[model samples]
Target chain A: MAGIVEFEKHPADTLKVGKGFSLAKADPDATPGYSGNKADGEALLADLDGKLTALQEMLFAESRFGGRKRILLVLQAMDTAGKGGIVNHVMATMDPQGVQFKAFKAPTEEEKSYDFLWRIEKAVPAAGMVGIFDRSHYEDVLIHKVHNWVTPEELKRRYRAINEFERRQTDAGTTVIKVMLNISKDEQKARLLARLDDPAKHWKYSGGDLKERAFWQDYMDAYQAAFDETSKDHAPWYVVPANKKWYARIAVQQLVLAALSDLRLEWPKAEFDVPIERELVERS
Target chain B: MAGIVEFEKHPADTLKVGKGFSLAKADPDATPGYSGNKADGEALLADLDGKLTALQEMLFAESRFGGRKRILLVLQAMDTAGKGGIVNHVMATMDPQGVQFKAFKAPTEEEKSYDFLWRIEKAVPAAGMVGIFDRSHYEDVLIHKVHNWVTPEELKRRYRAINEFERRQTDAGTTVIKVMLNISKDEQKARLLARLDDPAKHWKYSGGDLKERAFWQDYMDAYQAAFDETSKDHAPWYVVPANKKWYARIAVQQLVLAALSDLRLEWPKAEFDVPIERELVERS
Candidate 1:
């Protein structure tokens, strides 16, 4: 509640994609949220931590008290664009009991047998949870389009399906916060090179990453098309400028806090006799 | 690795249910794994945090590098018996990306239409991940038995199905760590009363919790039967004493660390020519 006042005008308002939004025109390095240096951004993020923690706790408490609402944070980004960092730094602040984190890797043999959203549907946060999808159902549209894995007609059908699926989730008391960590190619190259230079980070580097980088232009086009098609009001896509890790982290944290605060959650009332319970405890 | 050496004789080995094991004989207040005070246990848990984090990172890295094995932690406990505490305190130390936490609630209309494990099968952690079931497939047997929701024959069938399902997971490279947080009735009453006394915690308290408490002995008998029927070498269940929150948290952490260490995980070797990649990075 304390930090909530400062975030009345969220950076996400500018970053959120609307009709006919051009990904080509969006600057990946733009810090639209908080204009500050690295140190200042870090301090702001540290301050937001307590507010986010309290909000998540209340959300969980509300769910337990028969409140039916939950939140789903769908994060779609290119490789090395800091999805892992967001999960580790931003989500790690909340009580793990209330946070469900799912990283959608390439479809497994069994998963491939079902529809793409089948695995996703199973991972949707239950009531009283905040679900984070590192990479999600959008991958089917993004990579599949880039690689020509699906016919264009099939891709269009999948897009419609995605919209309906998300619509259903929102109708059923789920707030969908979809984010795309938009990082420039140069930034990605730098991040990849850093991983290569550090032996400890070698485990995270894969030969396939370079292969994907070769098709970066195609992937970008795919992302642009997917965003244009699937950016609905209920599940609007916010393109977070991820070149600056601190700014990106703070922006996403603020977006989440703002979404939760919008819910107007409060602690549920005790239905039983509190005085009698307190007396019982004292007597015991 | 330092703590791994100390855990050669895991306390879970003693707490584990063997053939003809009786839950009635188990003391829920006993701290078997640790022989220390709360402060000492907290210190020990802090030390294990780094080791657990390291091991989990290796496991995740290995999975990305094509390691097929995973870890599944099945936690089953009564209300107010500290399941949420175990998830928040013990499991929260791991990287969120590498850990999947699923808390099973009462079956939905659709979920009830399928076999109990149908929904659970969808939530098993993928390779290189740690899957924690806050409550799990075991619930069908535990609660259904207490409430007579299933016929005796159906209960027998469900027990068999659970064994076969877990066996399949193990065959597919998942190590199952099942635990029952054993808490005394008095401890549970005290916890419930604490929730009632605190306005902030009122949301977590429900009248149904009291109704369930009235059937405490029946629930205990149901759990005992479940343990006798489902406890196997591949998916053994450890009963962690839950009266002292610190001890329960530490004990579960030790059990998980020991299970992971047994896998002998390591940082995966890079497939590409590292020198060449390093050269390319420098040039770029």
Candidate 2:
């Protein structure tokens, strides 16, 4: 309540990809629906962070008591786009028990043996849990499309498979929320250099980041194409401008709050005779 | 700073097991080593919780740069002793990425097939991570011992095996800290009744809890025996008084901080050429 926000443009609308959405049209630095400065965004996030704990507990409680609903947040971004930041600041707000977090790296030999979706399916959130994927099934297309590892026909097939796979998840009571942390080329350059500039941050940097930056436009085009192919009414993608870290954090936190709020969860009614159990406990 | 305490006795010294330890000597109502009232205990937890995030990140950063050290906090307690609360408040202070939490329920048919340590071996903390076991391999002995599911000879064998398993963990750079949350019969009775009294908390109650409570004395005996058998130089056990929830949280958090601080982790040094990456990034 201390950092109450009445959004000039609600992220649910401004960030959602509509028909004919294009990567060329999105401005990486614009705070799309927010009328807040960095300080205001931080305050908004602080106010909202504590709200997640109770909702998460309700979800976990429901899961134990026959509730099938769960939440999945898929994070996709290029290097230095602050994907890890989202996981640290946003997803970690929930009790770790209620959060199932998996950061997908390159496929290992065992993973390569199966279809890409094989691992992704295994990582889906169970009833009443929130699952966060740092990089996900989207990699099979995003990276592969950039590298041309998959044939055009195969790429198209994989896209269709992904949509079907997500549909199955939703049908099984998982709400999929995908987020793309959008950073401009200049912002990324600044971030990568900032990491290199500091001794403590070296572990987060890799020489290959520069190589990937060269394919920036190609990756963006791949993302635009993937959104066009797979973004749906059930599982929509939201693009959060990440040039300002504070704004991106608040935006994603709002998206999470929106999805959980939609569940209309209530404290479940007691299934047993309260008097009987209390009497039994008192006697013990 | 707000909740700083000059300890009458540090938990490290007061709560640790000695040669002839018994659970009966641990007063669940006593706030050992902490001279604070409930309000003071709450302040201590708030001040201490913020300290974990930086420590956790340094450990994670170290792990990425080939540091082999990690921390493992094993939690053992009776029903309603607040194991779930510890995980939510204490362990959740760190990044979920750095914390691997597993709450052991009834072992499955598959688990029963393998040796008891089989499932546990797979869940040990990797380098630079902190692993918390809400209930651990001790259950294999505690419950099985209480139910007479194993012979005295088999129980002795399992105890030695657990010690050996933990030694291997420590030898491989894991600082294994085991804690048992001590609570009284009276307190557990109150907790069960409170759960039954509230509709929101009814989900946390189970009919089987009464059956388990009937074996309270037997379970306590089993715990004492297990501690005497398995407490070692490599993996010592600590008994924390849990009649006061705030005291338990701060005690466990202090144990966590002591374990991590003992490692003396510093921010990692830069592994790449700053000038080169800066030039390349600039040109891009």
Give the TM-scores of the predictions, in the order they appear: 0.81, 0.96
Q: In model 1 chain B, where is the ten-residue run with the lowest total lDDT?
A: B1-10
Off by over 4 Å in 1: A1-9, A17-47, A63-68, A95-97, A105-128, A137-174, A198-203, A215-235, A271-284, B1-10, B18-26, B33-36, B108-123, B144-168, B225-230, B279-284
On TM-score, the leading prediction is 2
User: Cα-based RMSD of the predictions, in order?
Assistant: 4.7, 1.7
Q: Model 2 over residues B166-258: C-alpha lDDT tens digits? A: 999999999999999999999999899888867778888889899889999999999999889988977889999998888898888888888
Candidate 1 scores a C-alpha RMSD against the true structure in Å of 4.7
DockQ of 2: 0.70
lDDT string, candidate 2, A125-153, tens digits: 98999999989999999999999999999
- What is the alpha-carbon lDDT of model 2 when measured against the actual structure? 0.88
Q: What are the Cα lDDT values of the candidates?
A: 0.86, 0.88
Fraction of true interface contacts that also occur in model 2: 0.72
What tens-digit string does per-residue lDDT give for candidate 1 at B71-97? 999998988888888887888878998
Predicted structure 1: lDDT: 0.86
